[model samples]
Target chain A: MTDELRSRMVELLPRLRRFAVALTGDLDQGDDLVQETCMRALSRVDQWQPGTRLDSWMYRIAQNLWLDRMRAKKVRGVQVDVEAAEALAGPNGRRVVESRLTLDAVGAAMAYLPEDQRVLISLVCIDGLSYKEAAEVTQTPIGTVMSRLARARRELHARLEGHTREAIPRQQAPKPGRNT
Target chain B: MSDTPDEKTPAQPIGDDLIMPYADGVLAPDQRPAVREALARDPELMQRFEGFLFTRGPLARAFDAVLAAPIPERLLEAVRGPTPQRTRPTVSLLGSVRLARLAEMFRVPDFSPAVAVPAVLVGLAAGWLAHYAIGIAVPVDSRGVVDTASLQRALEVTPTGGSAKIARGLSLAPRFTFATDQQVWCRQYALIYGDGLEAGGMACRAPDGVWQVLMSTPPVPGVRAQGPRPAGEGPGGNTPPNNENVLDGVRSLFKQGDVLGREKEADVIKDRWKTP
Candidate 1:
């Protein structure tokens, strides 16, 4: 790789780290993922067009690698129950509960979301990618990106707000005999 | 109600579809006035809007901690490629200068928590007794090779970025693997002691199937400085730096190529690190 490309990759490391951590829901795993992503990007350096955005290219690689890992984990039948693990914290249970109310609460709650939603939230919310930009990276329609993003945000809001659903007035309630 | 209906439907409830876009500030300028009016008039719509807006800041800041944390030396090595040979007439001084800077960045106080004696001789004696009882210490031979069965086994089986409990109160976590210019595969790992002390180093699998300890740092006082702290906190602050000086010392060992991926590393381990 050229010196300029190497420096650019180094500069993008922080943002890549952030996206990876949010995707993996653990710091070490995230760093590992980032390392793998860097290796892939470097090995395929010739495939990357010079004028194109390197950050987006790296993000796509990280996202694909994470999804592949998750698929392989599913095949191995070793899916971790994050909620169950949190409940069994024993002495640290209270601290875990209290941590849910802090700034890190959003990150903790993000673990509950499905992988697809987590990716959208990480791309749009955390990394400051525009909806259109996220769509391009993920290769989804902009409308789908917006709706999925909206649902993910709403789910995150509900999770962070605790169990009691907020009393928002519904547009219309189903009539008693509507179906009948 | 007028006989001719208007396009502006004031009674339409602003759902999350609209509220989220508005809160994200992605809504077009023409659509903002109506959402703004709705948000001003309806308390429920305002609540939903605020809900969507709340997570953006905290979510962004939550992972800033990861960004602020020091980038592992292995990752840096992967990026910079192999260190240029100092003996080469065409090699630039910039490579050595960068390595010097990295060494300076990760410099820690010279104190090994394992061997250090406390003021209380009783505790020291008991600690030594426990250490002997466990027999789980990293003993480097004269040639700087770690001669521990547990460590060697852990290094052999543990994948990159995965940790294995080698003995009581000691865990070994391999960080990454790279090949030297001579095609020697060296793996970097952190040996975490129970009392929040961590020692990081690299071990290369010699042709004879022994993991020769290339270098190891003294046990630093923190087990991964986690959570959100201020950005740019370096050597003096609470953030624990990884064993970067070890990488600096072994810079010439790295080859100009990609670090081994998961499957490739697994294959190397399965083949017992033999030449492929």
Candidate 2:
């Protein structure tokens, strides 16, 4: 009800949208999901105890709402809501070289992961949450988050490089010769 | 470990578990330097780290662009709706409890006719405090003080009827903030509900931040036409204009400047008064 909380929520939208985009795998539905999450948060502003992390709470809400939609879609026999998947804006060259990986390849590879694994990857790898924080967001134990994130990163890497995950060893394997 | 078998590292080999966190920079601070040293020594480990970084870096960066993109207006409207394209946003989708809270915070209802009104007057006239339906008898000394502790705490934290949490579950909210010509900081606060009307009072902060009681409204309407007694006879002059039951003769002794906004009030409470 107060502007302090409401304004903080407004500032968190872009980042929230990013997480949503990653979770839903489509830009448009993710935006819709973000909108729904914001509405729910605003209506229940009292539920958030003052002085806590707004972003984490928002991430939790977005995650829950996304999972709920996934369940409902399954019940209704629905597949990917591809209509809203139009890429928002393509990669910009201005970013530092390290972050220049294209969304198309990553997005395609990410599609292979289950919903939970994708969420773990989004939180830790994409959004930069620590395992403890990601666990808090995903409502899992730290050990589970760590293992899942490791597996997810490995799976995503293998998927992107056109190799089976078993072909990659944990220790010193022949390095891929990509010039990046 | 990778099975290249051609090269072996001198240091303890990094495990599958340690590789990602090291690349992600989430390894404990003490562990990072050793891991970094090993990463430098082992090209395969470095490659693995690079692979992990590649997985994270571009996706994170691509999403960072989305972070810069305009948050759709629909989302902003949900947070605070009816916003002007430029300045103040319009009132938003307020919940019923919050709406009630806002109402309670703005107005306090007092119904202690016995303590608020003269005993002889209570006998002679059934005033609005009595008529409003609240009858809690507070011990008001000659200074017109009732529930001083509740009054003081209400002044400090529970500024609104809905938001304030005071002793005994009674709620109070600040309605107006004004500085008297004497530079004394003062505000009007109300009892959440007694009988059916809100009983509000004005208090000025003493030099020590203690709020010295100035005056209180008997749970009567601020509007004049609804006055329970005639203009000359009833407590007149200071009845809030909106309450129809308050008489015209009941006046407040505290001379005040223009009422301040919520932020201005917060500033005054923090002893940072600036003229509007």
Candidate 3:
């Protein structure tokens, strides 16, 4: 039974890693967080009753760990290495840089949010957990989850569109936030 | 109505409470028509809804790169416990503890007390070293049982959706409180140790008013024999299981009573869990 659980956890690595990366907004730190979460989970494998969603369990662990790190102020600020991103742009430098900038812009905007909102965005928007599922993971009420997520999306849309306007001339930018 | 000019009529504005869910396609079917109608009538509302929709794809795809990257070997080793050879006491007694503390901090389950004692010593010593080096108090003890004074305070006063610092390196966040079938008040919480270790469990308030730990999920034995499998051997990773939700395990412990709300929980905290 334990062996089967371990294999299932191994299978869960990719998605877990993705969730971690999105939460931390850094590859190295995210993987470190993931490692710690796995170790923590493996240690408590017995507590994990069979017939429960391992992914949700692991996500809760990761979220709690991240929140702890945040509370400790141990997490470094979100740093996007523009040089590293540019270096990856080989043949299609312009397109790659553009997309990379968009991603970085989104990351930056997400970073500006409070940690709770950032967590909701990662769980519901990025990882595709339903509002109810996110609430369960965070131990928040479903209404609180929806309201927070809604606010997060609104802020993210504003920030990203604001970023786009800064990149392009204001006149050329689409007027999404403008009132008719 | 006739007094208002046709061109100056205000467009009906959709609240985020409604439009955002509609944009995410999760809105209830009955509630969708109003939002859709507003979107159709108000170009501005449609534009705002589109803005919410636009960020979804980019945010979803932002971290896709990590998925394609290879899983790190250290992580694999973490899940697969210490290798068999490392458990053998070929090295000096202290050396094994050092290795255990360094490579497998919480993973040395099979270690006998002879090894476990020294490991604790090394952990304490390392905790002190880390304390001085990093200037933050490192907690040597990682038990999640709610025995400490600070933990007790948190369990008593800290309401659900709240957290409290139990020690320099340990924090407690209570998830929720419920009444068991026996009418005992039990609360679920997660503890984050300074060393990046997290423990979660449920504690029920005993008749004596002490929060007796009903269950704390500390590390258990198993996975020591398992080794890393090839990366692609399993099905695509990260598929969420269709089994019961994680919290379901604790459900049977409690009755069908509604989980205490914030105000009611506050009252319970104030009354010290005494029966009214």
True contacts kept of each: 0.55, 0.65, 0.56
Q: Calculate DockQ per candidate and list them.
A: 0.25, 0.25, 0.23
lDDT tens readout by residue for model 1, A98-177: 43244345555665566777888999998999988999888888778877788778767665654335222122211111
What is the Cα-based lDDT of residue B98 in candidate 3?
A: 42
- Candidate 2 CAPRI level: acceptable
- Clashing residue pairs in candidate 3 are A43-B219
lDDT of 2 by residue, B1-276 (tens): 554322344454575467788787767676666677877888877767766886777557756545544455566566656434312110111223433443343343352222323321122122322331121123221223334333444565433212452323334556555555556556555544423344555455543333444335545423333323211132347544333122111113333545555555556545433322
Candidate 1 vs 3: which has more TM-score: 1
What's the lDDT for candidate 3? 0.58
The TM-score of predicted model 3 comes to 0.48
Error of 3 at A154 (Å): 1.5
Q: By DockQ thresholds, what CAPRI class is model 1? A: acceptable
Winner on lDDT between 2 and 3 is: 3
TM-score of 2: 0.49
Q: Candidate 3: where are CA atoms >4 Å away?
A: A74-103, A163-180, B1-13, B82-276
Instruction: Please list the C-alpha lDDT of all candidates, in the order they appear.
Output: 0.61, 0.54, 0.58
What TM-score results for chain B in every one of the models? 0.42, 0.35, 0.38
Q: Highest DockQ among the candidates is held by which one?
A: 1
Report the poorest 10 consecutive residues by lDDT, candidate 1 chain B: B85-94
Q: Cα lDDT for residue B43, model 3?
A: 82
